[model samples]
Target: MTPITTFFRNLEAKCCASCGQVISEQAESYATECYTCQDQASTDAYKHYYKKN
Candidate 1:
């Protein structure tokens, strides 16, 4: 089976907009939120799911 890790590797070098630390794209969206500064982005996935209904 293909490891999901490979797909996530590229996002590792992404620096957090709030914390300035490397955060994966996936993690940036879900686990985003600045680790050092403040909120990075919106955690809209949860709202989007219910909003579609």
Candidate 2:
């Protein structure tokens, strides 16, 4: 690949909002967190919601 292409690709790369992990280019456009962080957040939310009931 040309240097210009590489530069543009890196320039457009996205990172996880929570952990700063580099997000995969193939990931969904609306995803803001990495899979690991997403899973942890889901688990925490589940526990918190259930504990209140």
After superposition on all C-alphas, the RMSD of every candidate to the true structure, in Å, is 9.3, 4.3
Which ranges in model 2 have alpha carbons more than 4 Å from their true place? 1-10
Clashes of 2: 0
Q: Model 2, residue 44: displacement in angstroms?
A: 0.4
Q: Model 1: per-residue lDDT, tens digit, 1-53?
A: 65878666754566755566775455537554445444223345556777999
In the predicted model 1, the residue pairs found to clash are none
Global CA lDDT of candidate 1, please? 0.56
Which candidate gets the maximum lDDT versus the true structure?
2
**lDDT for each candidate structure:** 0.56, 0.84
> TM-score of every model?
0.30, 0.68
lDDT at position 20, candidate 1: 68
